[model samples]
Target: MSDGTAERTNEARGRRWRGRVGLSIQSKLLIMLLAVSLASSVIVGTIGFLNGRQSLHDSAIDQLITIRSMRAAEITTALDAVKRDASLHSRNLSAQALSTSINEGFAELQQEEPEPEDRAALETYYSDVFIPELEGRTGDSYGDEAFIPDSVAGQHLQAHFTTQNQDFDADYDTLLDDNDPGDGSSYAAASEQYGDYFSRLVREAGYEDALLMNLDGDIVFSAYKGVELGSNLMSGPYRETALASAYAEAIATNSVSTVVLTDFERWIPSLNVPTMWVISPVGNDSRITGAMAFQVSIDTINALTTGDEGWKEQGLGDTGEVYLVGRDDLMRSSSRILIEDPEVYEKRAVNGGIAPSIVKRAVEVDGTVLLQPVDTQAVEDAQAGESGTTTGRDYLGGDSVTAYAPLEVEGLDWVIIARIDSAEAFAPVSEFTRTVLLSLLGILLGVSLLSLLLAQVFTRPVHRLVGAVHRVAAGDLDVQVPQGSRDEFGDLGHAFNDMASSLRIKQELIDEQQVENEKLLHTLMPESVAAKYKKGDEAISEAHENVSVVFAELIGFDDYARGLSPEQEISHLNTLMRGFDEAAEKAGVEKVRTLRGGYLASSGLVVPRVDNVRRSVDFARNLLGVVERFNAQNGTSIGLRAGVDSGTVTSGLVARTTLAYDLWGDAVNLAYRVRSVTGDPGVYVSQTVYDRTREIFTYSEAGTVEAHGGTETVWKVA
Candidate 1:
């Protein structure tokens, strides 16, 4: 191949490579749109997920709170019922019948030393006659001694015995034998009758067991076991708890006391089951004689809380469980076994089967206890005697939302804790979130694909238009873009073609005008100055007082021009002043003019309508910024000195054939003198300007100076 042809081919390949390297406007736009869409999708999806999770968690907490409140209400109702029944039984027992039975039965027992056969007969006779008579009416068996019976006489006795032992023996003998029946028997029977009535009422009122204990702590009678009728309750833990609770109730002016029985047995698989006791005093003449206690089975509580009905079915899901705990933190009753750890249960059984710490903590921090999912601190704030709910990690490492409510039973400090596994509680939300995320991802993917396709479709016309414009710019005016459907891009294509045609026609005239303007501007001012004036920044008319202005003129410019032609002189001055103009501009100062072979420059508040004085000061400081830059860029010997003065100046437009606005006042004149008198070719400013800006700049006083205006204090700025 010929060398000329080979070079041409290489140049063509280079141009093609450059064209490929540059991206089309359409491609850039498509990329930006995709980036924005993806960012928006991610933000929206994250927000949706967070909002959904919060909503579900809040709902679970609310449900748990409601359940706990209901449990407290039920327990309170049961206790109140027991109290009412015990009070009624105490009030209904007649004092007269008690005295009469004791008196007459004692008299009859004293009249005979009864045989075993007689004793059996008397017991039968008393059961059939006196007991029936006493049970029939409120006052019929209440005569002084008429109601007591004897088996030998086969009749009722009518007498009174005064001795304590004789009276007790007569009462007991009359009720148990035909003769010599002790008053104790009659009193015992009466007590038994009253106790049986009391127990029956409590049982009918829904309690599983009931007991009546005297002030001395002796169990007089119990519904569950009549065998322990005469046993002293003071030795037992159950009775001790009851006594303490009763005393507390009395001091606190409360009528009921509730406590939990935490001892576990082989019968109970879980150590959490607790028995609740409600104790109320049996009173006569405003003095408490004894206390009547109602005992409810833990199983009954479980049944009530986890009934076959919709109690758990309502809002609580399948895995949700409700239970009661004593103030001592022992589980009274629960629908499910809460103690999941076998080791813990074993330890509890070995340690008296009571969770003392749990009870204390519950009372101290009356909120949900979660052991799994994650360890959380106890909710101690809930024990303020108000029902409250909280959520935390449960044992087994799962999220749980639980509610706690204080139960006001007579002798027991108990609370109901209703808990639901967070997973089960918000299963619906989890499913929904999962479904939504999947759906959104799919939708986003589909949208992205569709956007890509749409981008391709729309970019085709834009790409073609770009190619046509490039061809025209490369001098291929014959190139034409195919017209697609009438759209914005179609109009753009037509506009581009018209613009190219117009540019081709006016290229010569425009180039000639540009060349002439450049030459004329260069002759009138330095290149930097001409550029600034072209950009409409002719004079530093926006200059404020306390700003520095600098002016420099060649000392013998006229003499230098004497031997040169007009063009040579103009060119030399332009070359010399151009460096200064560039230096001032780089220093962030406005070069106002370079007229009649002189230069004028000022810095600080030079921009018209500037609102910030500090910015103006910053600009003045930065004016020195350009001087150093200029010296570094060009190894020049020339230097500039500036004078700054802090004072007011008049700023307005001046009309010549061409309009000009400039700063004119004593401050500007003084600034000029300060710059001219400077011994060194650096910056100089009046004392007023120095004072205002000294904190931010290093400077030295140039003492006082006499200028075109008047003598003023001046300082040099570095």
Candidate 2:
């Protein structure tokens, strides 16, 4: 073809291509919106779903942890109460006098020979009864007691044993034979006096009984006259019980040592429920003589662990619960399942191969969980002294979310486990995600329909300006509106191009100005406080649990400025203040604000940290160095007095007409007060700060200063 013909044909093809492109862009606008909107909706939906699920899981775990903590505290308080009562009684003067008199009387009774008829009764009890029992228990140590069957019977007494959870009769005749504390008139008097106090112990102290034990772990006086009063836990049938362990632990501990708490066990005979013992050494100033053991009530424990409507009130959801587990793999509190439905729980236990003894109390006791065995990660790890959370099989053989921690009682190998069935725990999360997804789908469909209606209606008004509008949309903004249509469409095209250019310029200016303004605002206050202020926050305060605060006061600043020009003094003070600011910045500290001739700064206020105390100390010490340098270079007579304290503080902007950011609390006030005690010229730190820095920084205790309504110890930072 000729050149002219070919050029004409190419121009026609280009025109057709532009016409098709413009038509497609306007007609399929809804499809474009659908694709972009659906893409954005899906991304947002996925992120929100993940966050919601994780948040639910985290919140559940946190609630469980709090419940476990509360239960542990209640149990610890009960144990401490027992310890306190036992320790007080162990030091009782009347009790001590009675104990001494009983020992003396028992010694005297042993010296005298037994009466003929009493000896005859004791011999029959020993030879015919006690000796015959010994053949059955060949290795039993109590049966091998010296002064038994071979000699004349001294006296007969009753006692109980719990070596294997069975009752052993304490029928030894010590007075008729060799040397057990014999019954006498003086002994009876002392016993009578103690028995009166024993009645007081039971009635007033809320204990099951009160027994005064001798140094050899033998009960000397009993409030209830039980069989255990005369029984020796060391060699008697109760040798394998919690009492034996408690006595041994108390004996190992010194007289001034803290009380010992034994693990849970069934104190048979007199007590049938699971019992824990709190033991404290009984003595005067000389030595640890013996121990007084007190029984901890299981009812009080069950009240706390299963309180709040059996864990539901504790945020454990439907199948949630909190209970204690011991190292012996037994429950210290009742199972909610068994308490709620004993027969069903028993059936479940039997199916799971659990012994009948565990759920037996479920029927007898309405809510007691004692003596029931459990096997789960919460029990295993917590008993091993580990604190953790996990999703796994629970003791009742269901998937569960659990948090576990060891208890705080001494000598007790027990752990607290808080749990909820996983299905119930995550049901809310699943339901929320499903709801969100369904809502998003409906929104997509609705918006898609709206977009199509909009596309068809909106395209008609702009079809006359399509070619020009397409050119503008494709970034050819210099295209002019084809006039003769002096209408809104014409005006809209002109307005669109003009407004787009103006917006572009404004956004660029905003980007540049925001960066510079943010820096200035951050310099005026802290970055965190500035952000809150910019967001129109009226009251701004945050509690920081671990922060280090520094207060440096420039002593004699008024005197030094007296002889200088106003400008000169301002320049001089600025130099010193600037140096202090630089040092704080270098050491990663935040300069809070300046006071009259003083500077304030902090570490870990914006973000918490463990090393905030160390950071503050380094900054405070460097601040001292800055003052030292200033004095040497300028011949200034100014001295340094600075203080640091590490603890909780509330930091925020106090927008009182003129906005000023500051920190307040006991920690801050203490830091300011401690500055006065550092008149000798160095950084002085409070005990809290010193504690955090002692491992790395050398310090000397500078006694204490009256601050925070009390005397707080101060240390000189060397």
Candidate 3:
């Protein structure tokens, strides 16, 4: 045959084969199954990822809140401890005796009258550091001699000794020699021993320095610096400053027990750092000899805020830390890495997008890190006395989750902030999502291949069974599918028929159970409240007009119950309360509840009535009558103390797992408070209740009664 005839014959053969079927139901079923499985996997995997991320984020916030609270508490406790120890030292007997000796020794040195350079140095410090501090300028650099580089204040005193050692050892010896040791009590340490005693105290106390201030505010002795002797904070350049306030508070008080603490300030010349002082009186009963002021150490605070092992040891992760910020938004403590290792810290600072000022301070290049701004949202809320967690930009300009709270210090507006990088907090969740997605993709591929092999056997029977299910789903449960096909799917249709029949009967039973549940709910709460709950309302409340509220307490019941077991005690209380409930129902009043204190009941709330006041009073009296009969029967002395008040009240169901029917307003509060008036066993009615039910119940004057709001005239019901 020719080529053209061969091509025509092959095309005809292909058409004949296609005519038998275009796409078989088996192949269609396979593709559809694969598509559905892949779609379901994608949807479920996405949901799991989102939910897991949220859970992890919430956990991070909770952890940060707990960490911040612990850090703040530690700071308060540590500072208070140090302050107490220093204050005690100032009142020591040896310290007081030494103060007198030091003052006298200085006075005698004045009589010696030499050392012009020593006089000049002290006078210069007074003018440079003290005056500038009073004017409120930065005090650190102002003292020309105070910040003479690589030296403390002691260097200025070396000039007076004519010694090149640049310290006060020689001058200290001269002062001790000049001192007239009248009692010979032996404070020879003031001379030869010099700063040995003060130095030991500073080292033990962990203070930056210690100063013995004479009544005139002269720096008579110092552990680190003693250059400002004869300079008075009261009438000199340091007047009107925090140290002056501490002095005035200590010396002006009559008690030798006086110890005053000053807030933080910049100590300008000697040490260019924030300073606090604890000044305590050193005196006998007649007069204060002098005062000992110790400079508070800031290193203790830095250590506490930064944690025991620099944040990580406290479960604060790589980016997590707790630090302090003042009201002015400046850092109160040094950064963790900054204090530990500055070179490494600077690299991190740059990578973290930390502020320029903070980087400068962290490396000690500019010393501005202590004053770096912390303007995050958590800090702002904390300054307003609110404690909570939030997600926002941190001081390092990174996305972070933060917990912040105000430190409970007496005179400081500092906030403690605990935070972690969001990327670090949510990394595990992201990894989980990636794993889930990969797993879903693998399962989808496997299922698609398996479905192709199995579809031929499943399609025809499944199609017939699907129609039967659709009818059942549409509420046509009586539709009988053909179970004629001899296969597992055909058997499935028969089981489905049985399931539908059982479901219809079960549904009828559920309807009946629902009605019973409704009835049960009405028994616990007011019917109106139950109705709202049935309508899917989470909370129910309303204002009622002219409701009479009765509050009654069982006196001596709690103390009496000490004689019984836990179960028996509860049983006894329930028996008495059940009697009160019966009395309320008989009088047409509604019993709200009986809790720890007493039973609170009301009238004209669930349903209004013009005689609610009358019903309330009758209910109170009947409850007491029930109590009396019980006392006589059981040989007990339980007494009923009741109060009746009629006015507008707010009633509602407290939305909890166990619902509480309650009332509030002046009427309810007054009724409860009046129960505490006296030990009588009668119902006490307010003036409003008296006017409404006076004719029905004979009443006697209960007189002006003291209640919660104020005293008001009440009456006794007979």
Candidate 4:
């Protein structure tokens, strides 16, 4: 045949071969197996991740709901207490008689107009002190004419108690103690006679202030002698405020059992700090005369919502808080961020679309009540009387998991919300997602490798090699393929065995390195502390309130060490230190660290104990035993001088590069000082330690030593 014909024939033959071998059975099977494995892994991992995420989200919402319910109940209980107190005070005979007397006296005094000097003093207070302070807080300029009282009695009372009191401007609350303003007016006379009664009531009941308003809404008496003492609630500068609204509601009810609670608002008479009042009509069942008001303390409300500033202890984590919002979408309780870090709050508030002026006023007043706007979806839903949990933007415009419910407080449009930042709330879910994705990737990689290996080793002669490959893939690195065949398969088996050996060696090295790293980490700190460090918390610190500390100095050890060689000295020191550590561990004391010739240990640093001082003294006695044993064994005249103190101490990791756990505070310092006292070699304890452990262990009074503030009495443990 010719060359052209031969080329055409070869091309046709090559095309036929390509058509027949396009996808081999092995290749097809491998592809199908890999597809199945990949689909299975995706399905399983996706389902698991979704389930875990939903569970975490649900848990976060449920936690917030629980906190909201708790805060709501507490607020309701507080309001109920206020209502009870108001009812009790309204029914008291003294309150009724004083209300009648102050009203009659004020009406009679109004018949005789006040002098020009007294009126001028009252006008000066409104223009200079009250108006300036109110403007400073509310950021609104006011005219003195609006606040100036029209009644002579009002002017006279203001002149006597408000403008004349020296400490009124500095601390208006102090006026509660100034019963007699020396004005000799009937208001002052009434205060002198019934001042003790009202003072006792406010002090014992924890009311910020008390006011008696007549049937005409004229405030006749004030327990704290504030600017509100003479102001008229029905037709005064404060008539448009919540205080007047609540008073009107109470007076209109005409029932002593009815108590109206007003939501927090800026009351100028109180210098515009957030104030709420509980109003109840003061009357008998037959006739209603007037209404009485009890000023609810802002601190009391803040303490309830903020959990006394112990948010973490109350289970509201770092970014979680419970707060109240009014119908106007303004916060009725203090903001957590405002309480924790006001600068951060200002920055975040401005960034979150809140006006800088609002944040400025909030910071200036040192409060968030009726200042920080919380016009969030949660607040809106809660104000609409709905109770549920949802994830949405918080007041700071950060995504949050929030649970909200309308408060059951009568005469108030308020809702309670518990919330935490979404970043913190869903952190575990995010971690789980990352872990699932990585695990799915690992699964796909393993399945692909397994399918390729299975497809490659299907022949009878390569069965032994296939089994060996499978074993190695299954993490059994000890497997060896048979080399009986003298063909290429045998060479392949030899290579496979070598690869397995190399993998085993590498894995062994990796495990050894991991073990060494763990050892080094644990050697630097306690196991718990090491775990925290490994988890990326670099700043590990804890304040131990009542841990007993001990500082022991090796008496005469330096002289003894000078006689020995370097190696001998190190060996002896190691032996003595080891003995001391064993004794400390046996006595339930944690060895803090070892100095050149000193040892420090503490009890209740790692764990809290009421008898820490006693345990610490016992540990000190064990050190004496340890030193005695060391001397007896080595025939040396070495002694141990130790001191112990029981009080608060701070302990944490120090040095970022080379971390070291250390304890230092008043207790630690006094313990070290007491150890080096100019006396015989023995254990000495500070007065704190002695006082705590005296009932358990007998102590002899030793000489006093100079301490931080003055002298601390030392006691020798006998």
Q: Who wins the lDDT comparison?
A: 4
Candidate 3 contains a number of clashing pairs equal to: 3
- On TM-score, the stronger of 3 and 4 is 4
Candidate 2 residue lDDT tens string, 1-718:
9966974785565445444443344437657776877786878678776777789768767777787787778878866777777777776766666567655554454455655655455445444555455445432333323322221211422311111112234322111122223344566656555546656666677665555566766665555444354566777657788788778767777673547666667654343456767666667657755666666666667766777355666676667877887777878877777767787777777666677655555555554445566788678888788998989977767788888999887666778888888888778787877888787877778777877786576556576677766776786645655423334444465555455556567768989999998899877665777888889888987787888899999988899999999999999899999999899889999888987699998888875666888989899889888988999777687888888998888888786468887899878988987877746778899987877779999998777888757788999987
Candidate 2 accuracy as lDDT: 0.69
Which lDDT tens digits does candidate 3 get at residues 252-322?
A: 88567776766566564233467778887777667778888888856666668776555777888776777
lDDT preference between candidates 2 and 4, better one: 4
Model 4: residues >4 Å from true position, as ranges?
A: 1-16, 25-29, 32-36, 39-53, 165-169, 441-718
TM-score of 1: 0.40
Give candidate 3's whole-model lDDT.
Answer: 0.70
Give the least accurate 10-residue stretch of model 1, judged by summed lDDT.
264-273
User: Every model's Cα RMSD, please?
Assistant: 29.7, 23.9, 22.4, 19.9
Using all chains and alpha carbons, the TM-scores for the candidates as numbered come to 0.40, 0.48, 0.50, 0.59
Ranking by TM-score: 4, 3, 2, 1
TM-score of 4: 0.59
- Across 683-704, the per-residue lDDT of candidate 4 in tens digits comes to 9999888877788888888778
User: In TM-score terms, which candidate is top?
Assistant: 4
Clash pairs, candidate 3, are 139-268, 140-268, 361-369
